[model samples]
Target: MSRLRTHYPLRATILEGRFFQLSENEILHSISLEYTSELTRLHSAYSIPEPDHPRPEISSPSFRIYGTEYDEVNRTLVGVLALRWIHFNDYESFVGCQPNSVKLRPQSFNWICNIYRKTIKSNEDLFTLITSTVINDLGKAPSLTTDYAKLTGTDINKVNHDMILYQVIHHPAVAETLVPSLTKVSSEHKHDLSLGIKLGAEFNFGQLAQAENVPACLSGLKTDLKNNPRAFEMRFMEQLLDIAGAAGHTDYTCARKLVEPIFDSYKNVYDVAIDIISGNLGLREGYDIILIRRVELLQRVGWKRAESLNIRDKEKRALMRLLCIGGAASIKTADLYYQTFTAVNLSRTVYEGLVEGLNVDGSLEQPAVQPTYLPAMCGLAIANTANGTTGEKMKALTALLTYLSRVLVIDKDSLSFKRLPEGVIVVERDLRQTIQPILESAAFKHKPDILTDAPMPRDQVAKMADGYEWSFTAISI
Candidate 1:
């Protein structure tokens, strides 16, 4: 992780306008003018030819840049979904107007460049990082909204934008921009660069884990580039640089404090979970694992309208507060649903209502909200809940586990429940074996007392059991 720097250079004066409308040649000229010496040095170091083909100009930049929009035209959602749309120049001038609303700001070409200069100090990462960031949000283009809807059968609100990006990587506009043919460029250079861009665009393990029944490599980029370790490294660098770039955006100390931990904990939780299942108790050769506590902050959407529409965002947060857990992966689509017991004064009814409401279909904001994976373990972290009673934590655990059983099929390993769209077979035994050790490790480190408490009712345990021998104090870590 990059150390927190007190001062960061502001926007480059050369990139001040709507450059996306310019021709590809003009765009390249402007970039070269801004970083003439740096590009010269990088091209020499990497032995790559300068971009020759005229790339496609970016169009419709307002898609997922701001979060979900629901108007009458979408047909699935009622009422208007209010989203923030501000120019890149406005974001450049943001000092401390509203720290909580940073996610609302969309990334313009200038914003991308500002972050890029701050984060990428190494010459080795220059070309891949630049290309990846440029085309990372191609799926967010409004020109592809109808195509996205057709691909997923869901509104833009609930679609996987990363998948959409991967799907259109070969489209004329996107292909010309990302994987363009050049006169003197080696095929390997073009192939590897294209692979790196695709890897960065689609390597969203967090979102994949959050979505039910989706494998970590559902987008096929991982399988495509599995043999290319350099491509994977480039993808990882892009993600790290992204976080580092955001950390430098403001002078606000609180923002740095909030993001610094996520930067420091570089190990992927999903990867660690995989290792545990493979019978490797040791940490990965070079990486040290840390228990990451992620808090889903409030989005700047229309609250009154969302509440009227019974949007599940607020309800999930309410449940998080009540359960007192930092983070949890949902067995369904309600990602990050983890807690131990009541952290606030909210009634148990509120917690119960939140859980019960989630069990029903077509009740929440999303249409036809159904559980995708059966016999699947919803990974939840029980931490920072030393304040709760043993009985309270136990009851909360029972309630959650029982609810999961109702939603996911725990009895049989039928073919329908076993197979995922990406051809990954999720063995029930492997999932049960995997989640137990990880959860136990997290609990042992964060809240040790719960391991010694008595078990929940036998009937409830049986209903929700994931084939792990039921025990209250099975502290494997």
Candidate 2:
């Protein structure tokens, strides 16, 4: 046997400034003692690996005890399961406590709760819990902070109120619920809900339309446009003419399909104006023509129950203008004229009969509601200047701009009215200039990071950019 070299072992440092010199064997035994305590802690905290598990088995012999021997084997598998459990519990707690009264499954609730209980405790957990609880409870629908506060006892100040509202509005289930509600509400409530639903639906529908592997019919249309330009152009123009003619029909059933919700909304406004005018309630001098015109138009459209022919031709003309502006054509106009002239304001109170039938705000109250002249006027302005003078083209262009500006936020540079070689004035406004600003402004005012620059597909880009352009011809001088 080789002679053993004598080397002194390093002293062990312990708590409380205690130190001890030990032989090699003594040092090995001391390490083993601490290792055993740690192993016990880990074993108690986590589920032990099953014998059938693929990982290497834990064995005491695998741990090195000294220069020559090994001791306890497993120490790394300590707090993993405990940490995972805590995270899951935290997630569940967040989902469970949502303030919006949105219902969630018990299984999901329990799963997240268990994870939180097992994971590390921190403010992050509380924050998630609060947000999730609020969103879930609110039916996953966007609501005013005051509304949410009314529903959830939690103070609105405690969380990012705007973000919560945006999420609720955009939530799929909430949006779905709201779309139908928009159609059902009485006229007063219609304006508020309809505008909100339209905005949300347009955003969501655009996303759905752009999804990969869209249905065959829509995809076929996309392909035809891309592959056969001449055929596509002819077909598109034909379809446009057909739709416009269909939209202009005077029969109520035929017309309603094209303008039901909007017309219904306007009817509410007309009713309110009539009430205010008739009751001598809140009537001002400047509004007399407006009120009289509204009453005549309502009656002529067969919207009222009684009549009076004492209404003058000037008033009739004003009423005709109002009716035309509201999109009722010749037949509907005649009906309105006949109805309003015969019905008494007191025969059936306009407010009690019509305004009261609405839900929240008066008919004219919502921002998104537009006069019926909007679309037709826009189309006519676009159609008339196809071969006109530059000055006439410019006038039509200005009219188009004015129309769009009324409904959308527009950038000055994005408005481009160009005279084509064929002399048609083409108005080309970039939709991005109109729409992006709105999205950007909303995002910046709230949580700015939500606005993203993800690459959009070509078809999506086209749909988004559509209607931002129109063509017209001016009168030859």
Candidate 3:
């Protein structure tokens, strides 16, 4: 177990937005059989349907509708669902009351309600409901004052406040920030991995523990990885410890340091790829084909809006053309100097490399994280350059992890808001002052080809011509 940071955390998806009471069918359709069974059991026991994702120990879960908000990211109608807890006694009234006024709660309540009394805090100590039967004397009377969460036998409100603070920190999005990634090997160096480090969402240990099911149908992880000293459990423990350390729940750095030898000793996927990659990565060795293949790979993952480019523009335009074709929105041209297409593309190959890298899907507002540039570049740059100096190595190490274990919390309301490497260009920026002239020259260079028998948007083209400049530097034909 790791050292306690502030308080024991019980995390669940905290939803916020207007919510219509989902029909029985709607609710049942969304959840799994096990979840449906649990809900049924809870309704029978307390009349309240158990929360789909319950916050542990806090019973009688319910929700309230306030108003509606637009989901700009999802580009669809969406509603927020806030999690509410009804006290033990409020269960009967809560269940009996109409949906309209059911949002209200009991007046005389335990101090545990203090967690909900205030706006959740972003950072602080922890306080949770701790019911103790023992009686305490508060000057005038000997009474029950221990039902609410307490700290040092004093300041119950602060204790309650701390509990709210705990909720904020424990929120998956917030929790992800607390943890940092480790200095792991590069994707290029470790070739056999299928997916890079998952750093986008909350850590669901139960989901990861299911890695036991990842091995082939006939083989268990124990039998498959017999060649390695550390078994599946050991590898999982390392992963768990890394997650815990990054979430700032514990200081697993020392523990990680202790196992440095074992980690370094493990043979990775990249070890087997040395012979194969050496010849394939030489000068002018079908690099153009590689770019096409990368674009194909991008298309495989949903980036389909690609414009073909001739080899004449191949040297300066491959990546930028890919970027241009992919709709580089909010992309700093300086960051993507089109001059160094080959070097940049090579880096992409090295980064996305032999193993596929994880990319959070792209959107109009924020861009998807650069697929492999940040993570792979960081490790290779450090390993190749910073050999003797400890300080340099540590700096490089931190940078490497930042790229791998980078987690960005996304609103789960819609698929559009998810972070994945989406190849489609949502927002296209016209950085090319050259495009208008190119279009103008192409439009008028030779007689309007009007290859299509049907009418073209000549009116729209005329309107565009009024606003922009035109040049005929070179004829299209």
Candidate 4:
């Protein structure tokens, strides 16, 4: 019943035997013209450069149109997301698009036809050449080269990680794999990765469903073992990662990069023998896997709420800045140092647990060196988002130090934290007086759940992981 429909204006020209160049600028321009700030990623979006050099950069300026802005700049993925948006529709079978030709507009229809020698007949072939050009171009980006060199991990590993993040994880097919086997999904909630993605794309184009019904679309996504009885045990983790990434969780990019490494770590550290490819982890209900999987629910709920009500991305960032500030406060309270492992006191049981957890192979390798401070590092990453420049970072830090000094914690040798306040301050003085207004500046009339939801399961896992590390570092345990 909606007045607007999805289509491609270019399908006719290509059908007439005339090849066209797929100009990146033209495609982005059409998107800008058709979509609104609420529809697409107006600020901070996913970008895919190439299928070969697959790294999903947090892109921007997809081409500034008339006056409004669209964020996220990946020629390949953006184009595909746009294509899906044009082609997909409400029917569960997805029957709304023009069957023969893409709905490319005349002015913006040119794609990379010059490189083709054979007639590019199938839509797939054209897609391939177009994305290849994007990937080749992306591989050559100055920022990519710089960032590639700077990764502490090897270049090959970095590219591999990026490929997994963009290509393997974000593949439209990966989500589709779940459909046939998806179990216990209600009539209204029969969501697979394919549908969720299509819905998200539609949402990006400002075709989001009403707020309340959005849950039905996402309910099929939430992983209740009872609901999805036929769930593939092994693919669950990857599916979760894909869903979460698609739905927009903060640390997913890093999570995807660490997937294989973390799998190896789990095998080594916790002795979790998970075979990722075969979908066979000997254990039933691995909490680590669950920890990763449940985040999709958080992202789905949060994103639906935000998009349904048309909340702007800036407001989201402002809220995230506040959350990061809170994270910084917790990290500061712990006084956890990452520079070098300093001795710390822990209770006997805590120490014993650390010994057991850290020393899976009986030998305590670098017992004194506990890298349990990754959570704090996560915190720092969040807090740093408040400022971009050296001056701004300095100011934020100053503001933080000023705020923390006000909390009445017992000072202990400037090394260990002995609690005095015995409770979280909830909000510091500076944050309450100055920061709160900035975050809530533009009223976000949406559900606000995305801004406020906590990853309870992830937090528990983090706690356990940190506790194990603390056991290693404990001065007394």
Candidate 5:
């Protein structure tokens, strides 16, 4: 057994108000003291900010320390994963956390709690919250999978966890006790609740299992279907909880803020693209310099491996930088542009159907203007990772240029994307004219004498073009 499991009994006893028994064994007393110290240290490292209103007294029996069949060890693992390392074995659920224990509350957590307390007011609501938290992972157990597969006379490997959950929850023996607890939810909603849970699990696990095969944008589509019309908040809740749980293990970092809130007040992705074309000093000097330096830096590293760039933010300046690079690449290699569009968001099986030349087999014509290239933008970020190819990076830069000329969005929201009407496509001549001055200016900053080398001999034009084609205006800087 794991060390956690071995110590579960002692931990459970202490949590269940048997603290008086700790002095019986000298070793146990020492262990208790050590545990207490760890809790204190954790609280110091991960203290939560005080919320506006006092936190509710969460006295539900479901939140009790030792009621569920899930032992303290398993609960601790779950707690660490979804609860920001707030161990279930430490106290009587989240609301009853000890003063010294770390609480993992963020702004999002407070918003969720407020909604739950004000809107959801029934025994069934409580059950929905509890079961979604604890029992959601029941299908993940190997033993359970084996037993379930045997019962259904199916191959264990072929039995998906979601399918197993759907069956187990509705099983005659289990449903007899489990189904009635959802007293307030209608029959239709009860079904949605189960499906939402299944979809949420898939949303979490599928991303890990099929990272390369699945597009990042479409990773949550399955869950979103359940959440359409905002009918099933439980799905979103489960996803958040699962991420919180696993965050204890994952080394997540925030992206660099490329656009401040005031500056980020763009109409949409397309608006940002237009702003890039208009060319602010920051765009020319800041973003352009970063791209040029980044590409050169990557080229020097040669292609052993590439780590994924942290390019997931929706800030305008960041989006503009992406649009400038990836869009330009797509135009330079229209075939690659089309190939990337077809390959993006399509399932792994569908992508395999495309011919090697990447000719679109269907009757779908090349879009007259820019299509929503959000997925491709995201894919480019992934391609820039340590393992990414030189060709992929080059393609990304070229595509960004194309985006500067031909971006559009229907949505007004800056945080999310929505497709709009076809925008004017900036051709190669226009792009070169607009970008050349900026590149020269950038070169001048690093080497003041760059202009002196003006109107370079004809022999050097092809070399410069080659450099620009691959890395987009390779300034020496």
Candidate 6:
């Protein structure tokens, strides 16, 4: 068994309250006197033994008396005078304790009064004041009490007592300069000091926890979802779908494993559609409604990433729309452009699916095809129509009409087919008949001069054809 050591406790003595009702200047002088008496006693009680060297050999002041200097007596006297003046003015306003009798004026006197009232009210308030004061004073000059508190936990009692301890531990002159007229209560208020130490330790612990990984460890617990397999599956599916849509590889086995179960679980019409579109398990040979729905679902997840694929461009998109419009008529050549057509059509479908999923307004609209590309498609149609069209004359007419029609759209007024001496008549006639509907369209409605009886210039027509071919080839490549 261990025996606890007993320590002798210091007794507290209260100064007389005569200065309480005095004028502000008188009050300050009395308070200074009381502080001086307390300081004298503190200095004697905690005095260090005389050094082996002579008294004159000491470079700095050794004694702090009455919370003032012992060596620099003149400066201490001047500070005491200043404190008296401040107290005189502070005491005058509180003559009667009536409501609103004492109006607080801006100065050090009001600060003193505010501190007094708050410290007397609650322990938390006192702790806050002591902590703030020590931190503030330490910021200006180092204090041993504050340094000790920083290292080992310590509590501060009333503001006055805390201030006194602060001065005793640090030098009196420095403490006065940093926090004027502050002092700590005697050992009777040790409980207040202990309370402060506990609070301070807690505050420091919080800061340390944040600085280290303790908080991070706690946060990881919230975000880590190891128990939920469904969420894991969803995230995994999202990754695989993104890679597959990006044309990464033919690793359909991995994708099939994830998608098959989701399909079975949902078992909706849309889920079937997604399976068909993803090629996890192809349904009917041609593209169907289910395939379109799958594409729509993928689009709903990530449109920007999906759009980066080369197959999801304008020509493919237009062909998909044509299939949707023409149905079986467009399905015959589905295999020829299946990859390209499927990507475009699915992208559009995905976009619409996402918009619907999110309940956003406005339907997904298809982008318009440029007018210039129309002539090339028309030429293909014409070529297919010809029965054994083998003459150089027929080939020349087709090439000439294609060029002239493109130029007519780009430079309507410069239709000069006469530059070609051979077969100029057939080219001119074909241009007029082939472009008739285009000329009547809303795009050309505003340009009435283009449709008039103006024959194209021979030299200008040749130049425009050259420009048209360069642009067309550049776009194709």
lDDT of 5 by residue, 1-477 (tens): 234335644334434544233321322233323333222212222211222324234321112322322222222233323232122222124323323222333442355444445434554443344445444555545554455455655433223334445555655564423323344345665665766654443233222111111112122232334234232355444444443333221211110111121011111221322233344322223223333333233334442111222233222223223323342222233234334433343334323322211211111122111122233333433344333454453344333323332232112342221121122111011122223343324343333223233331110000111112211121111
Per-model TM against the reference: 0.36, 0.16, 0.17, 0.26, 0.33, 0.17
Q: lDDT by residue for model 2 over 1-477, one digit each (tens)?
A: 011112221111322112122333343344334333322322222211223323222322223332321111222211111122223443342222222323333553353334334431333332222112112212222233344445444333222222233333444444323222222223433232323232221222111111111111122223222333322222222221122112111211111111322323233333333344244334222123333444554565565422542224443433333333333333443453334422352133332322222111111121111121233333344235435544433344343333333322212232121122122111112233233332324332332222233221111111112223211121110
Model 1 RMSD vs true structure: 18.7
**Where does the lowest 10-residue lDDT sum fall in candidate 1?**
76-85
Residue-level error in angstroms, candidate 5, position 153: 1.2
Encode model 3's per-residue lDDT on 1-477: one tens digit a residue: 111111222111112211123332232223212122222222212111112422223211121111221111001001000112221233332223223221222331222133223312211100010000000001001111122123223222211111222222233443223211101212321221111111101111221121100001111122323343222322232232232112111111111111211121111111211211333322122223323443343344454333343334433233422332222222232123222232332345433321121222233333222221222232232343223353343333332322222222223453433432232111111111212222223332232221112111110000001122211111010
Model 5 residue 402 CA deviation (Å) reads 24
lDDT of each: 0.31, 0.28, 0.22, 0.25, 0.32, 0.27
C-alpha root-mean-square deviation, candidate 3 = 26.7
Residue 109 alpha-carbon offset, candidate 1, angstroms:
25
Q: Of models 1 and 5, which has the larger TM-score?
A: 1
Q: How much RMSD separates candidate 4 from the native structure?
A: 21.5
Candidate 5 residue 475 C-alpha distance from true site, Å: 53
- TM-score winner among the candidates? 1
**Candidate 2 segments whose C-alpha is farther than 4 A from its true place:** 1-327, 341-477
Please give the TM-score that candidate 3 achieves against the real structure: 0.17
Off by over 4 Å in 5: 1-109, 171-192, 201-231, 248-477
TM-score of candidate 4 relative to the true fold = 0.26
lDDT of 5: 0.32
lDDT of 2 at 390: 40
User: What order do candidates take by TM-score, descending?
Assistant: 1, 5, 4, 6, 3, 2
